[model samples]
Target: MTADDRIAITDLINLHGHLTDRGDFDGLAALFTPGVVYDVSALGGGELTGLEALRAAALALGEANPVAHHVTNIVLRETADGVVHALSKGLGIMADGSAGSVTYEDTLERTPAGWRITHRVVRPRRTPLRG
Candidate 1:
């Protein structure tokens, strides 16, 4: 991938946070492939397949969704498999002033429209115990 491709992929990952924070389900769904696989089992959300399923889950959240989503530490890697692997950290600020962090493991591919996430696994970050 070229430098522009890397930039585009980074932008795509960042855009997800913006769309989700705004509750723009339609726009959020467009960020993924039609047959995207979104796994949030770590958060008890179960695995959601396809764009329609993703949209449904987002809409179901309603006002219960986080007020803001901040993504950082986005590391992109291109493998021999022809897919870009993106590992990022996401911090969600809730309406009640509580915040939680998770690691987003994503795989993106180049599509006709642009680079899109084909698969994502949302893993909750555990607090490290002090010895």
Candidate 2:
């Protein structure tokens, strides 16, 4: 991917976190394709397809209002299939006075609207086991 592609994809990832944490459901859904697959099963969240389903799932799974989400350390690569693959770290300041983190693995495609995420898998970043 070119430098512009990398920046665009990185911005898209960060925008998702901003919109979701700000409760801008429509804005968040607009960042993905119509049939985007959001797989959060690793966090006990099942796969949700389509914008409507994604919005509903987000509402259901989201913490109460006033949450903060931050995305960082984005790495983007263009796969042989012409898809942009992205990995980033997600940090959250939850409403319940707790903090958490996860790793986001994303597949993004260039769409008419812009570069949008087509599929994403959220996985827990495990700590190294004690020797």
Clashes of each: 0, 0
lDDT of 2: 0.83
TM-score, candidate number 1: 0.92
Clashes of 2: 0
RMSD of 1: 1.4
Error of 1 at 10 (Å): 0.3
| TM-scores of all candidate predictions against the true structure | 0.92, 0.89
Write one digit per residue (lDDT tens) for candidate 1, span 1-131.
88999999999899998887776777865679888999999999999999889778878987778899999999999999779999999999889999899999999998889889999999988796689
Best by TM-score: 1
**lDDT of candidate 1 at residue 106, scale 0 to 100:** 98
- Supply candidate 2's per-residue lDDT for 77: 84
Task: Give the Cα-based TM-score of candidate 2 against the true structure.
Answer: 0.89
Q: Per-residue lDDT tens digits of candidate 2, residues 1-131? A: 78888778888898987888777878875689989899989977789898888778867765553388889999888879889888899887777788777899999999888899999998876675689
